[model samples]
Target: MTVPTLTLNDGKTIPQLGFGVFKVDPEETERIVTDALEVGYRHIDTAAVYGNEEGVGRAIAKSGIARDELFVTTKLWNDRHGADESKRALGESLEKLGLDHVDLYLIHWPTPENNNSVETWEAFPSYRDQGLTTSIGVSNFDHRYLPQILDTGIIPAVDQIECHPQFQQIETRPLLTEHDIKVEAWGPLGQGKVDYADTVIGEIASAHGKSWAQTIIRWHLQRGHVVFPKSNNRDRMAQNFDVFDFELTTAEVAAIDGLENGGRVSGDPAEVN
Candidate 1:
């Protein structure tokens, strides 16, 4: 199946559905990513901190897919917030990925305690200008950080956040919309903390003849957020990619949206530093 793309603020396009290797074992990354590639996933999201970029690179090399057909993304880890450290970090990540440039590179987290998020963001453009990464963005950033980052005369193309049916990020969505920054939902399936089988999601999934995971993925797509759900299992990887065949109705989307109850299942951006 062909995946839809989203145009970033910089005019570059990203595949809306991709594969993520957040906690995948380094030893298993190559085989798992190869399976995902075989299942028709061209966009792969990994980070230096994941300790699996080399495996991802190996899979890409072995797959024999052309470079242009893939969208690869990696991130700058929290400890590398200094200007020089950030550049060096990307260099190391590129070396590991076996690519000269990544399609997108992100600040993994705000690391608010360091008081250097803006400084880290400031160095991002140079990475793009020097062709180290085509686009730059921030992840797990609170809306409060945007104004400061905006003052640097650059707007992020997207913000990768921990979003699912339970924690909708209402407080940050308006600011992101005002700035034309797209949302990339990291835990689109709620990171297993959400029990889809017995909730409204289950009912919605039943009505559509789709699994709860698939239904939520459909909800994310219809909401226009870029989503990449991860799985070590090949069948589940194909299932996640199969969302393009059906579209969710407005009411169905609303019912899923109504599941929000401030249930954030990951690190708090404010405290991650």
Candidate 2:
């Protein structure tokens, strides 16, 4: 099945469904990413901080897939928040990934205390100008950081955030909507906080003759948010990518969305430095 694509404000397109290597072991990233690629995933989300850029690179190299056919995303670690450091970090990430350019690059965090994000963001256009990355964006930037970045008049094409059925973003998403920022959900499966095993979600999955995971992924797609659900298991990796064949109804989406009860399993963007 073919995954749909979302066109970013920057005139670039990203696969609406991809694979993530967030906490995957460095030694295993190559094999895991290779598995994802074999499962028809054209997008791969990795980060310098994940310490798996080389493995992700290796997988792409071994796959022999043309660079233009794949979308590779990486980020600048929070500690590397200065203008110069931001440039240097992307250079290093490109080196490790064994690619001359990445499809997308993002500021990993706002690092609200040091307050160097604006300068770091300012340095990104040069990377695009120089062809180091096609698009630039941010991650874990809440309302506080969003306005600051917007005030600089350099809007990000995408915002990688922790979003799932249990912690659906209602308030913060509107800010992205207002600015036309595409939502790329980081922890799209909720990290076990809300699994497909739930009665409501499982019932929906059974009704559709799909797995609960597929049901949830379909919900993310229908909501117009980009999703990258990660998995090391080969079966689960293929299962997550098999979401294109199904569709979730409006009532089912609402029932699953109603599970949101302030269930944020990840760090709060406002508090995490």
Candidate 3:
């Protein structure tokens, strides 16, 4: 299956659907990542905090896939949110990933309470120029914080966040669009919290003869958002990638959109630090 790519502000392209290793055990990372790549996933999202970059690197190296054929993304952790530290942290991530450069690098979370996000964001352009990262963006950013960064006239290529049907992030979407930042969903499956067997998603899945996961992923795709659903299970990983065949109708899309409760399953970025 061919995954579509989103063009970044820096003129780079990223696969719309990616594989995420957020909580995969370090020991299991290589095996799972290898399975994902074998199943046709070209994008892999890891972070320094995930503690699995080394495993991801090993898997990619052993897979025999050319480095240029894969899209790798790593993030700068909150504590490492400073000018010099951001650059150094990315270097550390690159070393762990066993690559000289990454396709995309993101500020994991904008810890506004700590008052360091602005300084860290300011440091991103230098990283891009240094050739350490092809594109730079932010994660867990909202309407309030996004403007702060964009006001500097530096439009981030993408904004990765906790977006699922339950936590649609409607208010933040326009802001990202206004700044030409592509919205990438982090916890697209609600971290497995929401019942995929629910009537809404299930009914749509039945109509399309696809799994609920596939239905939800199709929803994200139809809406033009980048989505990465995390799973260590090989079959489920393949199932997540099998979303290119069907399209959800407008009414079905509305029903899924109506599931939004403005709830977020992950820790609030404002309080993470």
Candidate 4:
């Protein structure tokens, strides 16, 4: 169960497969996160807006896992995209997570309507300089906004985006690749919006003797994207992590790629503000 790591632009490495706590209940976050840790997940992704950083921190402390052995990620919320606001935001998130520094910090969304993402992105380097975060990136950002961020001479290490078979983000992938920025796929299973059970993916799963969810996760891994599929049930969490044994053939990956329909199940990056 050794998870592979991707090298970031800043020379840091991140676990390719991790656990994400997006909508998990705050009260149960500790228990859930604890279960994930026990199931062999070393990378944990949380956000200030998730309101569960305290619980995640509790689980980390209780596990007694050496801080250096784990990778933690949190995001600055949209409202904090003002001068020096992200600085305060990351400090608070660190406080909640009971950590002096996080492995990675991100701008949660572009929020273009606010017209301040560039200003927000400009300050990210300073956070890294201050040792508040080791790597800085953005989420839910598309080409429209990324160019401006790039113009600031700070290329993001990764762009956490909603990516699945149905919405492969064809328009944005090239841009990210061109910049050598890793694509961290959130909602890798389409957030339950696309039924993998009845599609070619299910057939592929049957052939590989794996679950539909596992098959999709394999697809993501095979495609070289960093992914954190969320699951509260320990068994399912383990199942998701059990993808390393099998490999999807090139044709099989092409079959999954065919499932792309150019649709997004979540917020439009340009409109999420």
Off by over 4 Å in 1: none
Report the Cα RMSD per candidate.
0.8, 1.1, 1.0, 0.7
User: Among all windows of ten consecutive residues in candidate 4, which has the lowest summed lDDT?
Assistant: 142-151
Runs in model 4 deviating more than 4 A are none
TM-score, model 1 to reference: 0.98
- Rank by lDDT, highest first: 4, 1, 3, 2
Candidate 3, residues 1-273, lDDT tens digits: the string is 889998877788999999999999999999999999999999999999999999999999999999889999999988888898888888899999999999889999888877878888988988889899999899998886887888778889999998999898888988987778888898998898878667599999999999989999999998888888899899999999999877899999999999999989888877887
Model 3 gets an lDDT of: 0.90
**CA lDDT of every candidate:** 0.92, 0.90, 0.90, 0.93
Which of the numbered candidates is closest to the native, going by highest lDDT?
Answer: 4
Better of 1 and 4 by lDDT: 4
> Which sections of candidate 3 miss by over 4 Å?
none
What TM-score does candidate 3 reach?
A: 0.98
Better of 1 and 3 by TM-score: 1
TM-score (all chains, Cα) for each model: 0.98, 0.97, 0.98, 0.99
What pairs collide in candidate 2? none
Q: Could you tell me which 10 consecutive residues in candidate 3 have the lowest summed lDDT?
A: 190-199
